[model samples]
Target: MPIDGLLLNKLIREAQIFEGEKIRNIYQPVNDEVLLQLQSGFLLFVLKNPSYLIKLESKPNMPDTPQNFSMFLRKKIKNAKIIKIEQLGLDRIGYIELSVIDETFELRNYKLYFELMGRNSNILLIDEENKIMDALKKGVSPKRSIMPGAKYIPFYKREYINILENENLYDLNQPFMGFSKISKNLFYEYIEKYDYISFVSEFLDNLNVYTFEYNGKKEILAFKPVNFKYDEFQNPSEGLLNFFELQSMNSRFLELKKRLEKTVIKEIEKYERLYKKLKNEEKEIREIPDLEKKGRLLQAYLYQFKEKTDFVVVEDWETGEKIKINLNPLKTPNENLQVIFKKVHKLKSKEIHLKERIKITKKMIDYLYQLWQSIDFVEDIETLMEIKEEMIQEKILQDKTKNKRRKRSNSKPYEFEFNGFKIFVGKNNIQNDKITREADREDIWMHAQGIPGAHVIIKTNKKEVPMEVLLFGAKLAAKYSKGRYSSKVSIDYTMKKYVWKPKGSKPGMVLYNNFKTLYVEPI
Candidate 1:
């Protein structure tokens, strides 16, 4: 649930119990979470995240490791005594005053500010003069900036108010808070019934904390949500922790998955464009045959042609047909024929090279397509990371961050058993390379022909591979390819010996001959 002004007021009230406690230690378990261990049992929890921010009783597992910011906090005021805790009206601004004994035995006052302002929440350590010493998140904008050594500016929406001003219903509630929309709507009724300040205080004190499921989303509320039966939690913090965990698990993974997909799709588009260019260039090469015929005809009629400075009338020796041939005017009859012949030879030369180019380009497109297909089959974060690592290793993805935590996992193929025959399907290009090269020569290698797909190997162990096993392998290949949703897919299979990788070929590119094709509906 969104931590509106009302929730922050409640949390601030809970945090006041730690006012006299001595700060024993500080820890940053995660990048966005902060823990303060007090001499009293009451630990001060401050969470500063783009997602949500709240002050609560933290029951988080402390990491054995600590971040640099955590260590800085430990050194600054390890044994500092908390003098006071205050909530600045209903602006979602909070402050914790600390008294630290200086080196010379003089006492110094410092303040830690918690601005739980929705997605822009921040925590700042400040001196008596409000000069920022440090911040969990240092935000810089055209109008404001939070930087170390700079005088801190208190974040306020409207001109600073001396007291609660009833300019509007919202303005009145802004100094206090409402637990629900219904409660907020009743603000006018309460205002007429009792004094404004007393009514607000009563509302905050009367809120009952509980946990409930609403619209299939786990929510922790200070009041029982209106229409749904809820599981009651004596401790609001524990329920909120569970809700945050369950909510963020799917969200974080899905966010990473989308980023990975964007990277893959960008690369696939490039390869696809190259494939079309190569195909178009190969089409242009077809005109070479007609050009060659014209050159041959000119060669036969070289002596018969009378060069008219710009054009020549030539006779086809085979058909005795008269034809007009445009000449260079600056070259002899033999030189003219040689010029046209050279042009035809050049295009013909390109034909052989282009055929090889078209082959490789098609393979590259297929390789990228297979990589795209594998993303949907990734069951865990581990598998997704493996695919990302493969792309990075291939120089297809450039790491933008200096601090990328890479967990190296080996290329592991999907293993299956069909009729006692072990079948392995490569999930990505790296795995495809491994599966093909490591398999026995006689192992049946299957792939969706002319489609971007996985490489499937049936481990026959030199035994007579059954027809049923081949069909199974074909289906596996199709199921892992771009044609998985198609009505029919053609799969090709042959011995591993036929699938040979040439030097300088792309990771999953291979040449295969003597392969038979089989039609199968992708499973």
Candidate 2:
């Protein structure tokens, strides 16, 4: 969870670190993480993709030299003393005003505004006249120009319910004292028990870190605890950092997943469009049979037409139909007959070829759809990377941003163990090809029948697996196939000796003959 407005307000209100401390230095460790060394304590600011985070942390080690934003902040407020810190009403914006003496011996005030809105969060340094000195995210948009020397624009102008006022809770679009939606119930409970001012003051003074952990799952919250037993930490910073790490991992995973989804979806659409065009072209070749009949008639009557002719009349022996055929004026009747035979042969060949082309295109569409399903069902980043690499190998995914060659990710097959027998599952085509080629001939191979998906193998060590382990492997095969969400999926299993990758064939495309099919619902 994010640090909400109420928790932030409470954190700042109770923190004694800012009372009279002077800013000694500032450092930007990465694009999103920042460190502020004050006279008495260290403050860490993480303003990555998820709004912004502020915590009184230990002095972190700087990884590199300061960047442009850090340099600008150091130049302006390096040695300035903190005069006041305040939150803008009940909004998520906070202000840290500084007092600095100019080179000419005059004291000046600079305001550093911290806006914690999701995705749109920004930090701006404003002068006394409200002109922006610099912004964390500098850009010019229709609504505002976030750059140096532009007038600072406040986040919003809506009327917010003051926590201390006698306001109706139902009319509020947001929490009166908190930022996240999770704080709503707690706020109502507090309001029911005590007056607004007393409740907020008490809540702020007694802030604690609450973490819920069950069955290897974990989540951290700022204050309110649920019915399930949880861990309470006296230090909120530790809780905040723990939660931040989890959120950062989730954010990165989501980013990669979205990019992969877009790539696969676009590829699927391309193949579908091709399939439609080919189907239409196949319609034009439907007259091949009639053309063949005409060619045979002209050949049968070739000797009778000894002179040149503009047209020919022939009678079909089977249907007793008279057909008038147009011919080239400059050519003899035999020449016209030869031309008709050649045309018939060409059309016959082309029709056969076009039908095959349509079949191949349709098959490609099915494979791309299966790949789409595989990507949608995967949850691991390693699996996604492997799938992306397979696409790159097949020329399905093109990276427009890459100008130089980069090394591939070090991903391998997913490993599982059941009944002391090792089970391996391929995450993508590349892994599937590798596993099938390198495994022992006696090992068992498993895959979803009639679907594109990961290949599962059980290491037999020259020993046959029992029904229990075989069923488990089949379950995994179905779970990773195109029928992952469907019931009664058929899975095929056989020894490694029965499965073979054809020479010069595409990756993950294999041939198998001695396989047994089993039906089961995927786990």
Candidate 3:
């Protein structure tokens, strides 16, 4: 839910908990978000769509290279202590009064204003005289100038009565300052269900905010949401942070999924082109024998062709058939024979090189396809991060960080319980390697046969594995495979002892013996 003036008012009041806290650090995690690490906790001001400010419980990840606005804020108020935090006239505008030591070794006062109007939201730094120093977004408009050196103009005021001060005279049809449309509607519902006096008393005394599901989506309001189960919080800031952080995580997950899919698809196209070219070169190997035969024919007929000519007729020694050999008229017959021998030698060498290239290219195409299919199985941002980290390690994508060491992910395999057997399915190549390596010798292993797919393992505990459980595992393997949409998929299964990863092979690639195939529909 978008933050209205009332929500911003509640947020500003809750922000007072960190009034005297010193600024420990500052960061711009993305272009639209800024995180303030206070001595007490982390404060974030998101200035993009659905903008709001809250005190986070922990610090979020920071980019290695800071944005220009973040750099400016860090230089100006890295260690500044908050003098005060206030909301302007119950509007969606908030300012933090901070004091920091200037270059002259004296304390200077500055205000950071957070304008939380969607699409027009901005965080600006103001001097004591209220002149704009810099803004998160610099712009020029007819009503206001958000550029440096321009005077800071607060948003146009609307004459709405304060509901707390004039609750008896306030009408639902008239504007109530700071109250959102939802809040206004809730006020009418409350007055109709109960009485105005009790509603006013509760509104003034309420210190907690509630969050609930409405229309299958989460929403937060100052008053208790009607006809829904809700979670209550004494502090509004924490509630807002928890609710929005979850939304942010889901949004970030979807964005990363689309980006990874695009990257993998692009890589697949590139490798497919390379694969086709290499295959075409492989066709040239078929001409090697013909070139050697031509060289031999030229050697035998070297004396018969005395004059410079483009063609010479000869008899094939092996087939006893007449053959015409094309020659380069600029050279002698021996020179032509030498050229044919050179052509034959070059083709032979290229044939060896082409074979290796074709093999590697086809493998790459298969790997990229696997990564593409694996993206659909990703359930969280951490899984996407793991996939992205894998790409960076493989040099398929460049690492955006500046020489920063990435922490290794410990993402576990997806687990399912069926018919008293525990089935573990790998989500990505790394997990595939882990699942197979860690399984017991007698545990059943399964995969989609002749296709890029997840590795499935059933922990047998040295018990006799049932046929039904094996079929269940096979269904899972097919579901996660590239052939997921097929009516039926072939799944190969064997004991863990019979499956072995080949030396110098790619991740998730393995060779197996004593395997049985099962044809089953994807689960």
Candidate of highest lDDT: 3
lDDT of 2: 0.76
TM-score of each: 0.58, 0.68, 0.76
Off by over 4 Å in 1: 4-18, 21-81, 87-91, 98-113, 119-252, 283-285, 289-313, 326-342, 399-406, 410-426, 429-450, 454-479, 487-523
Residue 306, candidate 3: Cα error in Å is: 7.0
Candidate 2 has what TM-score? 0.68
- In angstroms, give how far residue 280 of model 1 lies from its true place: 4.0
Name model 2 segments beyond 4 Å from true.
10-50, 55-79, 84-91, 115-176, 187-208, 211-220, 224-244, 272-313, 316-320, 324-363, 400-422, 485-487, 521-523
Give a tens-digit lDDT track for model 2, residues 44-76: 656654554556647766766678888989988
Model 3 agreement with the true structure over 4-32: per-residue lDDT tens digits = 77677677777788999999888999998
Models sorted by lDDT, best on top: 3, 2, 1
Flag the better candidate by lDDT, 1 or 2. 2
Tens digit per residue, CA lDDT, model 1, 205-293: 64345566656766665544445577654444455556677677767667777887888799889888887887887776887776677
Error of 3 at 157 (Å): 5.5
In Å, residue 97's CA in model 1 sits off its true spot by 3.9
Q: For all candidates, what are the clash counts?
A: 0, 0, 0
